[model samples]
Target: MFLVALIFIIISYGMVDSLRADYAEKWQLDFQDPATPVMEGIINLHHDLWFFLILIAVFVLWILLRTLWFFDRSRGTVPSKVVHGTVLEIVWTIAPSFILLAIAIPSFALLYSMEESTDPAITLKAIGHQWYWSYEYSDYTTDSESLAFDSYMLPESELKEGQLRLLEVDNRIFLPTHTHLRVLITSSDVLHSWAVPSLGVKVDACPGRLNQASIFLKREGIFYGQCSEICGVNHGFMPIVIEAVPLKEYVSWVSSQIQI
Candidate 1:
């Protein structure tokens, strides 16, 4: 039983990298490939943290088994009455503070990178409905007539052979790779959240309020995610499908939607 458990854990760990690679292949923005220095740095730091946690867990488990039997109270172990050790308390607090700082600095840099903007060539406004998504371009003033569309979840029977359920949409949002886009997201009814893990974005869609975020797709591929917040019965049906295409293809797709 122990051997079987160990084998399963090892196999699962080995597949983790492949799972990440699959996401990369399916959703890496055309210009924002995994090879970018910014994303690569973040992924590497995440890997390091995972390594640290796994090593600590294994060491602690080993110590528990190797010492528990020898230190059990029934086996004559005595309790110590040292409840409040100021030095120990201070040490634990300060160590965690340093550790958090180590994680925070890199995280803040990535955040700033996402927020940086010189001049965005395009803008998209996303409206979250009870169970659908509406997108408007050119400040959503109708005069721009840039492009507007509603995206509904594709029904199970309507899904393409390779399309996964709960992630398929009727009209997937299209955007150009290597371009910075400002997305203004708001809710039509209740609160919802628009999140895409690959893009490292998660922002709330508030009712009657406009919230914006910038996305710079460096790669070209399809990325998928669903409404992250529980709004209602159909919340699970709200999926966001973004296809980052080459500049030419994206522009053409936008033009095609304008005719709709």
Candidate 2:
């Protein structure tokens, strides 16, 4: 009976792990699995900061509890008349500065990496509308036409089996794995942010001004995101989907689009 129960538990855990694919789950507290190096860095930094946070929280709680227990009136203990110690003041101040320094070093390194430019194999231009997203593959053009398409969220009524509601889009941006990609973003109407948690990408879309970000997908998967900024009434309807495929598959897709 014990062996059977252990096998059942293992199977159940595998089922739950398989269901979590590049999208947010219900009541999820942890981040989705990272698909890019940038996201992996972000998660690592988060874990490092959490270690410090937990240590600080526990130390503060211990101080509070110890004070309450020793200085309580019920304990008949006398409070010390001494107010402040210079050593304690300096220790607290200097210790926090060191902690801030430690946190800032890695943060600045990650920020610099995110802004670093690379010789991209593909350039994708994303334009934000009031309630939708449009993508253009500017690098691959057919003399007079470029590969461009508008992506809109699929309504619940039209959703197919196993499709995630509100996260599914009619058109998804196709990218190639292990290739450096440059994404240029701007807005036609209002402010919108293109954000994908698993990819560690979130850039603001401002009218008349262009913003760029670099992406290098480490794996092939379907990642989902929504408009992070509030633009208008239908802001929630704008969803972003990216389908990463192998290099050969991506070439085929580009050829197909050009032929069309």
Candidate 3:
């Protein structure tokens, strides 16, 4: 009975978070952008080890119950009078070391991939100000125009239908799909963090310093984020939105904006 209840609790917690996440994905998604394959692999690693952990927990529970039912001192059971043995000692040590190595090897590979920026097709620089985000496309240049804009949060009354309350920005950064774009993040006023969970990109925006990360969007979508640093009262109002589109559409957007 207890085990069943424990399982229910676990299922409830998992389903609750999954449901909320699904709701966010359905209602809040302005576009369809799948998670990167490497991020999916990282999640698989977590699932694999968690399965082992659950197995270990079940095994431990069985051993405790067996001892209580038939081998306890109160049941007049004989204590295992055996002492240390070379084989048993070696088995315990070697088994755990192997498990640790198995988890560590892939973990390192994923970590390295997250920070790797090798000859990216484009680069975008983000600057965190008092409350808004300023973006400049460093990869594009022209004598007649430049792609730089300040993105501010849209007022609730001014927001479009189905737009998120605190997650919509006036000027969303646009990037082409299936392109490796490097982002350099920094702050002009204080500390802030640039994070969009689906893209698995998060880096601190610190003043007098710049941090970089690479993002390769697998599909076109509207990814939302907020100014993760509490700079001031309006901190809650500064939202970040990125509209990833096709290459041709992205170029047309640049041309349309620059002519204005």
Candidate 4:
């Protein structure tokens, strides 16, 4: 009865609204709703693995309880001297091997899919600084035109109503929904990480190395993230905001930026 109730609670937790960030909720119990295809795939894989985890946990707990109940001092006067059976050993070994194989197949498929970024429509170069992020939009403006900007964390005092403290930024990276994007990440100083949980993006930013990742937006919304790797004193202040919009709005935003 307890196990059934636990499962029901988990299912109810996942069914809650995922589009908006729930600041008041606990972290370990829920996953922020996914906005991208990669995030969706990740959520699916996590639920798939949970099934195996629950099965193994229940089996181990049952074995432990059975042993304590049947073989305790109050229940047994003499210890059994039987050795391990060959059939039991073979079954344990083969069953685990098959279970592993079942897990590996889907794991490999998801890994390969992440690496497969075909024909990207836009490319964004993100350079990490000691405590902020700068981005350049490629494939939109010509060589003479400059389409770059710095994104700094908005101080708590400047944040308006409903804005998240330490998570909102002055400038947001914008992109169009249903478009494939290639993001090149690097660091100007120490090591940093470009991470956003909703987008399923977490690429390391090395000083002299360029790391690439793919992002495909399935919907239009505001997504937030922070630096995953600790680089300096204000690492927590470096926030990332992505404003995904429609294609027409995105083009207009580009034109306005170019004009500015």
Per-model TM values vs. the true structure = 0.73, 0.92, 0.79, 0.89
Point out where model 4 deviates above 4 Å: 1-28
lDDT of 3 by residue, 1-260 (tens): 99999788767655432222211454663322335555565667777788778977898899899878898677788878889789999988998798789878888888988767777888899999888899998665677445788999888889754456777777888889888788999999889888776676778999999899888777766777777778888888777787778999998988887676
Better of 2 and 3 by lDDT: 2
Which stretches of model 2 miss by more than 4 angstroms? 1-20
Query: Taking the tens digit of each residue's C-alpha lDDT, what string does model 2 give over 18-53?
Result: 244489888999998999899999999999999999
Q: Which ten residues in a row have the lowest lDDT in candidate 4?
A: 15-24
- Candidate 3 vs candidate 4: the lDDT winner is 4
Ranking by TM-score: 2, 4, 3, 1
9, model 3: CA deviation in Å? 31
Highest lDDT: give the candidate number.
2
Q: Model 4, 153-185: lDDT tens per residue?
A: 999999765677788789999989999899999
> C-alpha displacement of 182 in model 1, angstroms?
1.4
- The better-scoring model by TM-score among 1 and 4 is 4
Candidate 3 deviation (Cα RMSD): 9.0
Pairs of residues at least 3 apart in sequence or in different chains that clash in candidate 4: none
lDDT of each: 0.74, 0.91, 0.77, 0.86
Could you tell which candidate, 1 or 2, scores higher by lDDT? 2
Flag clash pairs in model 3.
none
> Clashing pairs in model 1?
29-219, 29-220, 30-218, 30-219, 30-220, 31-218, 31-219, 32-218, 32-219
